[model samples]
Target: MQFRSIAMAIGMTALIGATLLAPVTAAEDVPPAPLPSQSLAPLVEKTAPSVVNIFAQKVIRNRSATRYLDGSAFWRLFRDTLLFGYGQDRFESSLGSGVIVAANGVVVTNYHVIEAASGILVALPGGQVYSARVLVSDQRTDLAVLQIEAGGAALPSIAFGDSDRLKAGDRVIAIGNPFGLGQTVTSGIVSATARTSFGVGDFRFFIQTDAAINPGNSGGALIAMDGTLVGINTAIFSTSGGSQGLGFAIPSNMARVMVDGAVKGQTLVRPWIGLSSRTVVPQIAELLGLSSLHGVLVTDVFKGGPADSAGLQPGDVILAIDEFPVDDPQALRYRIATRAAGSTVQLTLERDGEFHKIAVSLQLPPNEPARNESWMPNLSPLRGARVASLSPAFADEIGADSGISGVVVLEVRIGAGAYRLGLREGDIIRDIDGRPVRTVDDLLTFRTTPFKSSRITLERAGSVLTATRN
Candidate 1:
C-alpha cells in the first residue's frame, strides 16, 4: 500500500513538470522584463565636482598650566627655563566636507565643523585649495556659509532641490569625505522624514536615512537621483562611533535659508508664531474627535502675535501649512521658520470639527520692553552673570517660554560666584527673597540689597527650582 501511494505522488509531479516544460507558441511568448539600470556614475560625474573637502585648525593656549604655576615661583621658573613651553600651546585640527552652492565660490557646510577654528581651507577637485572664510554660522541649524575666491573662474555648483517632496523609500546618494578618505558616495533610501526625536540641534527636524555616514561626513551633500542637493549630512546614530546605516541630515530647505542670509549679508532670524503647542497624542485625538493623530494642538496663543491676529485660539489643531501636513510641533516650527519674515503662509487648522484655512503673515518676535542688560556687582551672589529683561524676542532667542515675563540670565562667567552657585544661562529669575522680579532693574535692586540666607526661585526650560545662598 505504501509503495502504491508513493508511485501516485511521483506520477502527479511528473505530469506537472511535463506541462511546465511544454514549448510555447509565438503568441504566448512575452517579452522579458528589462533589467534595472544599476550604475549611478552619471549622477556622480555631475555632482562630485560641487563637493569639497574642508580642513579646519584651532590653536589652543594652555592657560590652565600658567594659572596653576602662578603660586609656585620655583615651578614657574623651572618650567620657563627647562620645559621651554612644552605645556603652553598646542594645535587641534579636524576634517569635514562642504558643498559649493554658488558658482562664485559660496560654500555651505555644518557650523560645528569649523566652529572656533582659527583657520579653514577648502580643497576642491583637481588639487586646487583655497582659504575659506565664514560668511555666517548658525548653531541652531548647524549650518554655515563660507566664501572662497575663485579668481574669475566659474566653479561647479549644485542647486538646491525641494526636500518637501522627498518621501520614504526614495533613493538618495551621500557624497562626503568619510573617514578622511577622498570623496566617497553611499546610496540608500530615506528611512523617514520629519524625524524630531534626536537631540542634534535646537531644531530637531531631520531627514533620517540608512546611508553609510561616518566621521568626516558632516556638511557633505545628500543628493537625490536628479542630481540636486536634498540634505546636508550632519549626524549618525551609532554605538561604535561609525556608520550603522542610520544617518541624519539637515534638509536643503533649511540650508537654503542659511545660504540666502549669508549671501545677502543678513543675520539669520527665524520667523515666529506666538503659540505654545504640544503633539496630538492618541488620547487627545480621541477626545477632540480627530480622525488621526496628525498635527499640533495649540495650548495658548500670545496676544498681538501672528496667530492671534489670524484669530487662532487654543484647542485648535494645526493640520498643515500651505498644504504640507505637519505631524508635530517640531514640524510646524520647522515649516514656519524656513520661510522669510515678511512672507505670508496659509495655515490649515481644525476647529469645532471643521477645517479652516487662514492666512497668517510671518514676522520676527517683538522686542518689547527693551533689554537693559546689566552685569551684577562683583561682591554679589549673582556676580559675573549678565542679566537682561525678558521680552518676546529675547525669550525666543534663548529658547524660553515666550509668554513668560521676568529677568533672564544671558551669560554666566566661569569660576565666578554665579557659576559656583549653579546659576546658568537661560534661567529666568522669577523671585528673589519672596519679591517678584519683573525686570533687570528689579534684579539689580535685589543684587544690591544685603540679605542673609536668601532664597531665589528660578524657572529653567519648564521646571521651577529654588536656590539658596547663605
Candidate 2:
C-alpha cells in the first residue's frame, strides 16, 4: 500500500508539471499584463544628494583617573593630583546621518547626534566636508537644525511631503549611513502610523516602518516614492543592535516645525491646550454611550486656559481636532502641537450623548506665578542643585504634573550633595524635614536653618521618594 501511494503521488506531480508547461491555446483569450517600473533608480538619484553623513566629537573631562569612582573618599583624594594627570580631557566621537532641507545650507538631524559636541562636520557626497553649527536643538522633539557654509552656493535639498497623508502599506525608502557605511538605501512599506509608547522622545507619536534603519540612520531621510521627505529615521527596536524590521521616524510635519523655528531664529515652543486626557477604553466607551472606542476622555482642564476658555469641561470626550480623528491622547497632543500658536482650531467633542463643535485658540503655556529660580548654597542638603517654584508653564516645559505645587529641580551638579543623595533634575522637592516646600524661597530658607537628621521628601516621575542623611 505504501509503494502504491508513493507511485500515485509521483504520477500526480508529473501530471501537474506537464499541464503547467503546456502552452496556452487561442481559446484561453488571456492578454499580457503591464509591469511596474521595476526600479527606484530615478527616486534615489533625485533624493540621495540631500542625505549627508554627520560626525560629532564631544570632550570628556575627568578630575582623576578613577573618576568612575565618583563620590568616594579615595577619588576625592586622588582627584586633581598631578601624579596621574587625571585632569586631562579626552575626545569622544560619534557618527550619524542628516538631511538637507534648504538650498541655503540648512540641515536637519537628530538632537542626540550632536548633543554636547564641541565640533561637528557634515560630509556631502564626493568627499566634500563642511563645518556645521547648530542653529537650534529641541530636546522634546529630538530634532536639531544646523547651518553649514556652502560658499553661498545652493545645495541639493529634498522637498517635504505631507506625512499626514501617509498610510500603512505605503512604499518608502530610507537613505542613511548605516553602521558607518556611507550612503545606503533600503526600501520597505510603512508598517504602521501614529505609533506611540516607544519612549523615544517627549512627543510619543511616531511613524513606524520596516525599513532597515540601523545605527547611524538617525536623522536620515525617509523618502516617499515621489522623492519627497516624509519622515526622519530616528530609532530602531532590536535585540542585537541591528535592524529587526522595527524602526520609528519623526514625521516630516513635526520636522517642518523645527525647521521653521530655525529659519525664524526662534525657539520651538509647542502650543498647549492646558488639559490632561486619557484614551477611551471599551469600558469608558460603554459608560459614555459611545458607538465605538474612539477619542480621548478629558481628565482635567486648567482654569482660565485655552480649554477652559473654550468651554471644555472635565468628562468631555474629544473626538477630533480640525476634523482629524484623534483616537488617543498622544495623537491629540501631536495634532495640537504641530499647529502654530495663536491659530484657532475647531474641535469636535461629545457631551451628554450629543456632538458639538468648538473653536479653541492655541497658545503657549502661560508662565504665571514666576519661576523664581534659586541655586542651593554649599551648606544645604541640595547643594549644587537649581530649584525653581513650580508653575503651570514651567511644569509643562519640564513634563511635570501642573496640578502639583512644589519646588522642582532644574539641574543637578555632579559630585554635589544632591547628586550624592540621588536627587536629579525634574524631582519636585515636596518637603524638607516635613516642612512643605511650595516655593523657591521655602527651599532657600533651609540653607541657613539648622535641622537634625536631615530627611528629604521628593516626587520624581509621579512617584514619592524619601531620602535621608542621618
Candidate 3:
C-alpha cells in the first residue's frame, strides 16, 4: 500500500510538469509579432481614397481652311465662307489629380487643371464619379477650389500638415494619376524648401521634391509619412516630358489659405506690403555689412505704403517676417500675400548694421487709378475698346509697374476693328495723332474730331508699337 501511494505521487508530479511546459512550447512555436509591419501600406490605404482623378473637357473652335495653303483672292473668299461650314467645335480634354480637403466634398487642385473647362468630372476610387464645379480660382497662385455634389455621401478627406516646418531630406510620398495610368504612388525626399524662380506659374514659391511628378500628377497630393498633406504637386522639370527627379509643389499653407478663402465666398485676395526689393547677393551683403547673403535689399518703397508707414527705409534689408527667415524678396512677398488684409505682420529689418522688428498691416493694392471704359463710335479701331486710367491701384491690379502712368487699353472686343489693328489690352496709348493721350478723357476728346486716318503710338508690355489706320 505504501508503494502504491509513492507511485501515485510520481504520476501527479509528471502531469503537473507536462501541463506547465505545454504552454511554453506553444508560445515558442507562435512565431514573432510580425516585425511591427514597417511598410507604409496602412498610411497609403488610409490616404489614397482622398486623392481623386479629374477630367475636364472644353469645346475648341478650329478652322479647316487654314489647312489648305492656296491663298487666291477668289479661293480666299470661298474658303472664308466655307470656313463657317467646315469649322467644327472640337472637344478638348485634360486630365489631372486633386485632393479632397473637406468631408463635404471640397477639393483643391491646380488652376490650370480646370481652367476654361466647360465640364469637370471627379472620379473617386471604387468607380464613383461626380461632377465638379469650380468655386474659386486664383490665377496669381495657380490654385482652384472645386466643389463636388456628394449626394449626401461623406467623402474621405486628407488633413493639411504644416509645410513651413518641412525640412530638406524629409521623406515624402506623392499620389496621383500619372499619364492616366490610374492611381500611382511615388516616394522621394524633400529636395529643397522655399524653391523659387522656376517659372512654373504665377506664384514662383514652391517646395522642391525628387518625387516623380508627371503630367497627370498636377494637383495631386504630396503627403508626409503620417498621411498629412504637405504640398500639391504642380509641375515637373523634364525635357522629355517625363519625371527627371525634379518636381515642384505649391505649399500646403498657401493652399489652405486659398481653400478657406474660397469656401467663404471670398476667393483669394492677396495682400501685399506695397514695395519692391531685390535679393541681397553675396557682394551686396558685404557692402551692406551683413553676415551672410540672406535678406532682401529694399530698392524702392512706395510712399505712404505699408513698408514706409512701418518705418521701413529704402536702404533697409528685410531679414525675416514674423521670425521666419527671409532668404529672398520672393519669400517675403509670399509670406505677406498669404496673410489676410488688415492682419498685422512683424517684419525684421536691418539698417546700418542694426536689426529692428517692425509691424506692418497688410493692405489691398490701392485702386486709385480710375478705370474708365470708353467707346468712340466715330473712331473705327478705337470703337468698343475699353480704356482705364493708370494709377498705382490699377497698375497693381493688372500686374503692371506702379511707376507707369497713362491710359491703358483694358480690353478690345473680339473681331472688332481694334482687334484687327492689334490694339490689344495692356497697350498704353501714349499719343493719338500726335495728341498726348494721358487719360481716357484725352483719348475720347481726341477721337471727337474726325480724320480720314489716325496714328496711335502705344506701349505694349514695355515695347513701343505704333499703328496707323487709314
Which predicted model would earn the best lDDT? Answer: 1
* Backbone Cα, N, C clashes tallied per candidate: 0, 0, 1
Task: Give each model's whole-structure lDDT.
Answer: 0.88, 0.87, 0.83
Ranking by lDDT: 1, 2, 3
| Candidate number with the higher lDDT (1 or 2) | 1
Superposed Cα deviation of residue 319, candidate 1 (Å): 2.4
| Per-residue error (Å), model 2, residue 144 | 0.5
Candidate 1 lDDT over residue span 1-470, tens digit each: 99999999999999999999998678648777899989999999999999999999998877756577663667766667798856656899989999999999999999999999999999997689999999999787888999987686888999999999999999999999999989999999999999999989777899999989999999999999999999999999999999998999999999998889889999767787878677899999999998778888887687889889999999999999999888876788789878999899999999988999999998888897789999998867899999999877877676676655678998999999888878999899889888988788887776534555788898876567898887
TM-score to native of every candidate shown? 0.81, 0.77, 0.75
- Report the C-alpha lDDT of model 3 over 118-213, residue by residue, as the tens digit: 999999976899999999976767889999988979999999999998999999999999999999999899999989878876558999999899
Better of 2 and 3 by TM-score: 2
Give the worst 10-residue stretch by lDDT in candidate 1.
443-452
Model 3 misplacement above 4 A: 1-36, 63-85, 282-291, 373-396, 400-470
